[model samples]
Target: MFIFVILGLLVCTEAQGISAGTPVFVLKGEDLLLNVTKAVVLGKFDDFSWKCNKSNIVRFTFNDKGASPHYTGRIEFPENNFSVKLKNLQEADSGVYTAVVMKDSGDETEAKYSVKVQDRASLPLLTVSSVSESSSSCSFTVTCSSQDSHINSTFTCDTRTCSQEGGERSEGIPDTFLQVYQSSGSIICNHSNHVSWTNDTNTIKDVCHQQDDPEGLSVCLVKTCVFSVGLIIMVSAVITVHLMEKLNKNK
Candidate 1:
């Protein structure tokens, strides 16, 4: 079996050349899989080796296991598998990864990957605009925007509740969401991406304050008009009476 495995590894190395694929992005402190399982294989490969930036990472020998001291505690590989799992990743871990496989028949294949470790999303910014309010209710528009341009959403709120209106979101990427609530004439905006969050609050009391009823104001105005008209009529009647009295005395 040892002789056959060595023969297979030699043949595979001669037949296969290095190939690269699209780059992959992973969040820091997240798990990453260096995948190499897509190639067509005649049978199960016995010898597997993984590398980082062209430096040896780990290898499964027929009789023993070997791993680089740098990745001693942070890597895992299943028996006879070419793929590897890296756990608790860090920013410094981003680099080129390569996987090599050798079959028992001396045929080999290679797979390469470029990795990028990204930081957690930053605190989002919530902006409020187009605010219109009345004595009984308030209406406003809000937008939750992120500096990364990966997240952007619009929302609308009233005294009762707030709801999502429209927005843009990234595909195949983690999403950020927004929520709004009203309390005591204030609107609170919350922006969250599961890992981080931020908030913006605004008060509508200046624009939407408790107000007297419209019917009450109309009634008061009507009462004043009626009183003024009645007083004018009474004064005119008294003047006419005095003028008639003077004319009679003069005659």
Candidate 2:
């Protein structure tokens, strides 16, 4: 049975005569719509069928034979329509899908598709590697990490923009891509796939501390001054008390 199924797929793939639009990217676990042009004369065609990865997914016949049992209840075929709707898609469902319309005259109309199931890109991470300042400008080196932590890329940012320097891409990660953009004083690192995208942003002033210092420096300075004043007051009071006691004892 498996051998026959594989052979059937091979035959269908080879028999696929016409192709449609570019590959469709669909989010995993969502419904997918595989479109096929509606036959002009609904009564002329004897059977309309759909296949995924060359496996018979559903079929509709003029005789009311119904769809294939494998996709029963999970698939929808509107009356007189060649399009198909698949629900609760999984990664396994990602593949080439074909639709074939067979007419009473023995003619067939076909269309092919390459469907990809992807998940929305997760949030990425941005890290600062180093910051250097000059009289004129500040330069910063930053790293962006993929959502899955599989790919790490380094980029350099000047006053204007951020550009990629180097990176390592790991195998077996699906639908991974990296992008960097700088706007105003902010640098954004974006990670995406065909289905979705996510990004992390950092401001130039925060990373490089371009001015006198970061806001945190003011707080540190305040704390240091308070501590020094408290210490000096305590020492002065102790010395004054000691000298008064000595003078009284001498008297």
Candidate 3:
């Protein structure tokens, strides 16, 4: 029973080690530092190796360190620690990396990391689809987009404050998203991924005031036309009254 229990524990430990890898995200063309989570003692271990997708990339003995030829100029292995600095990461370089240590007694230890490389998100586009005005508030619909993703949302603003209405609608792209939200009296459209983000913005007050300009000009023109017509009618009535009084006096 004691031997069986020890074997079961070892199996469980190995399973946990493989499944509980740390997750790291880096942008394409950037560098990353993969740190070893397990403590290392160079004197206690006979060999150390770092593997990617089960293929060895670096190996270390007590006195020397070497890397595979494919990664010779792209990786830096420091002597003071077991950390590896990967330079100019590409999307193809994303994979599970494992650090394996072999003790002199033939026992093995491992630390695992899962790395992802992503591109920076594109700039978001924002446009007003429609606008309506009332005595108390102004309401508008806006569309925000980036690459293949888009979101549509509505905003209502009064003289002092603004709020979103009917929530938001969105279509997403893989590994990226579009979001519309309000901040500091401005509506912001943001496009984002794990690596980077970009945004576009417009002020609520400015949009509402622009919509008001045309309506204001129309109102001014109507008032001026009414005043001019009334003045012409009054002048014609006075001329007819004067001509009738003169004809009656002459008769």
lDDT of each: 0.63, 0.70, 0.81
Query: Which parts of model 3 have CA positions greater than 4 angstroms off?
Result: 1-20, 42-45, 103-109, 166-171, 210-251
RMSD of each: 15.0, 12.1, 9.6
Judging by lDDT, tell me the better candidate of 2 and 3.
Answer: 3
Can you give the TM-score per candidate against the true fold?
A: 0.44, 0.64, 0.69
Candidate 2 clashing pairs, residues 3+ apart or interchain: none
Q: After superposition, which runs of candidate 2 have C-alpha atoms over 4 Å from their true positions?
A: 1-21, 40-45, 103-107, 147-174, 211-251
lDDT of 2 by residue, 52-159 (tens): 876788876766646667777778765456677898888788888887666757746466778888877878887776676664456666667774654444545444
Among all candidates shown, the one with the greatest lDDT = 3
Clashes of each: 5, 0, 0
Candidates 1 and 3, the one with greater lDDT: 3
| Between candidates 1 and 2, the lDDT winner | 2
Q: lDDT by residue for model 3 over 161-226, one digit each (tens)? A: 677964253547666778899887688998888899889998776788633443344456688999
Best-matching candidate per TM-score? 3
**Candidate 2, lDDT over the whole model:** 0.70
